[model samples]
Target: MTTAYYTHADCKRHEMGSWHPESPERLQAIEDQLIASRINTLLDYREAPAALESDLARVHTADAIYRIRENCPSERSEYDHFPLDADTSLNAYTWRASLRAAGAAVAATDAVIDAEIENAFCAIRPPGHHATSKEAMGFCMFNNVAVAAKHALEVRGLQRVAIVDFDVHHGNGTEEIFNGDQRVLMVSFFQHPYYPYSGTEHPASNMVNVPVPAHSYGNVIRELVSERWLPALEAFKPEMIFISAGFDAHREDDMGQLGLVEADYAWITQQIMRVAKTHSHGRIVSCLEGGYNLSALARSVTAHVKILADLE
Candidate 1:
């Protein structure tokens, strides 16, 4: 089985604004880099499906879903200014694009769980680690990774699932959704004193949050994951693994100051793959999160996915 790459054209249509860092060009940049690097030749590509309402309802409340739908613009001009938060906005196509992004995660989950693919990477946009159970914040509309974890447990009958978030910002939404749930173990690393800053304080028991200082190098991240994340993950013995794969932590990205390079992402991917191979039969599903600097994000993701595809 090969690595599955899932994306959709609708994802590019959901634009926050022309100036937003999470632009539609983000997807094009990654895809262009993958094509240029010959990484596209090593993977099986699939178009993402639109998420079913029932599937999204698994993680987000019905009211939240209804609010998003109600807020959707009827026409392109109607959504000149639809705001979820100060940073997050919605346009006419935002709802459909969000559904497709979330659906990519669900489909990737199904592929891994059914053994049709050893692993998968969702090259989707309007990234989803920050959207909580009811609120959409931090450029996220729905918790895509959270929905996949819930589906794996509720539908696939998986006893335990682990979510590893390597985003520059904390996955407060995902943590809020799965906190105290014994079946889920969440390991995350984010730059402290950053955007949506509330991860360092009281955290859930199942959450292993390691806040790295600004300008810290990849060695610090490697040490933290080795000491804190791996031990907890080993003890949890998750039946499946999910990755909230964000590449904004790269040194070239202006979003955060953690000094991670492409090789660092590749190393982390190998570590996660080691855990998946040992405990979960190599079932790993990775969904995109935050990655800004076009060249760095594309290069880092290529390094990350190449490892996931076992090309290196």
Candidate 2:
């Protein structure tokens, strides 16, 4: 499989702070691991282009887009930060980086649909899935996967798509954006009683929000995917699959209390690939979301991408 690895240098410059867990070093670490594992040479590497304003308009309101664009601290010092929320901050490079992050997803979607590649993995940040249509929060500036899903449906003329989120925290933004939209089916399992918790209560029918408890191990996750996510995905028979790829649930990651390891990630990705192969013509686009512990995040991503690239 010709898997494209999409990323950009601008994505590495959108720093919140030196102490933030979602640092640019996270991308660097993933790259290091991919190189160390000898997986980098097997895939196609592409620079992420800036997303057009029209692309942003598909999923974000004009006001919301204006707010983010106007809030860039371009003329300020390197240390200056414009806070979007308590956790999310915009540095001078954030605007450009946000465009690049979202753009990577859009470009990857187009590339996959055009059959230029079998699948893709976007190593981008500030991690999305937390940013909503109306607001940016939780260290996220834009809903990258949501934007790409919209692109596939609205721009590319696809009728249906599925989003699989394995992040430790709920993808409140993604759920909200496509809540009542019939064209997309979202399946996710997050730590209940966790940060930005909103997936459990009466989500729309299109959303399969399975809330697992903290300290839940990989087996619990695997079982839920088989029993819950798989059924919905098979029933939906999506034309494409989008993944909010997050590694924060790793046992070694302090971002959340979950016992997932690299093997678990590989298995989950394999399952997604199976579904994609059966229904979506092996078309999948995955975007980075959250992962704190650098070592764990790097290893887990390497494992996940190995499966995406069919290296295993």
Q: Largest TM-score belongs to which candidate?
A: 2
User: Which pairs clash in the backbone of model 2?
Assistant: none
lDDT tens per residue, model 2, 32-100? 999999989999999999999899888888888888899888655867898878888889898899999
Task: Give TM per candidate.
Answer: 0.98, 0.99
Residue 279 lDDT (model 1): 96
Model 2 score (lDDT): 0.94
| Model 2 lDDT-worst window of ten | 71-80
- In candidate 1, what are the lDDT values of residues 1-312, reduced to their tens digit? 589999999999888888999999999998999999898988999999988999999999888898788887777484474888899988888889999999999999998888899999999977999988998899999999998899999999999999999998999999999988989999999999888796788887988999888998999999998999999988998899999999988999999988999999999999999999999999999999999999999999899999999888
- Which 10 successive residues of model 1 have the least lDDT summed? 72-81
* Candidate 1 off by > 4 Å: 76-79
lDDT of 1: 0.91
- Which sections of candidate 2 miss by over 4 Å? none
